[model samples]
Target: MPHVIVKMYPGSSEEQKEKIAQEITNVIIKHTGKPEEAISIAIAEVTEDLWIQEVYDKEISPNKESLYKKPGY
Candidate 1:
């Protein structure tokens, strides 16, 4: 099974989130060969003020060893 966590600022509509989840699920199925039923996804919404410490420092910075893809900073 493959799990995906999507973190973004709040305000996206339910319809948009649904499309995003479906699209991402398709991508995961294509790449990892995971079945749709076995995949899990979660969307985490955080405020801009807390984005740095919550995501950048905690996930993008110190977790390089486990990250396979990252955006240019």
Candidate 2:
């Protein structure tokens, strides 16, 4: 069994997380020969204030503005 944990800034949608989990499972299956049923994934969303970039010493804000942008700009 393979246990995968993904940590990202808070505010990701369910659909996005689901897609990420699926992609991670696919990679595990392809490289490690793990069965789909045996793969487990967990996504941990840290709040902006808590998720600080060590090099920058700053929190990364969620990309709320980009969500409404037109596809091609």
Candidate 3:
């Protein structure tokens, strides 16, 4: 069994996340000789404030809102 964890800013579409999970599972199954059902994929959506990075003492926020027209429901 293979486990994969993906963490990103909280603005990805459901379709996008599903596609990514499927693709990742497929790749893991192909390379690791594991069954598709044996591969596990998890996605973690973090808030924009939590996804910040500091550059030269300046806080840089990731533009997660631009990923979709409507983010959270």
- Estimate, for each residue in 1-73, the C-alpha lDDT of model 2 and write its tens digit: 8897777777789999999999999999999997999999999887666655521133223443544332232
lDDT of model 1 at position 38 = 97
Q: Candidate 3 — which pairs collide?
A: none
Which pairs of residues clash in candidate 1, taking residues 3 or more apart in a chain or in different chains?
none
Give me the candidate number with maximum lDDT. 1
Task: Please list the residue runs of candidate 2 whose C-alpha ends up more than 4 Å from where it truly belongs after superposition.
Answer: 53-73
Q: Rank the candidates by lDDT, best first.
A: 1, 2, 3
- Residue lDDT tens for model 3, 1-73: 7787677777889999999999988888787889987888999886667554432113223454454433342
Note the Cα lDDT for every prediction shown.
Answer: 0.91, 0.74, 0.70
Clashes of each: 0, 0, 0
Q: Any idea what lDDT model 2 has?
A: 0.74
**Which candidate would rank higher by TM-score, 1 or 3?**
1
Runs of candidate 3 exceeding 4 Å displacement:
52-73
Count of backbone collisions within predicted model 3: 0
**lDDT by residue for model 1 over 1-73, one digit each (tens)?**
7888999999999999999999999999998998999999899998999998999998888987788888587
Q: In model 2, how large is the Cα lDDT of residue 2?
A: 86
Compare candidates 2 and 3 on TM-score and give the better one: 2
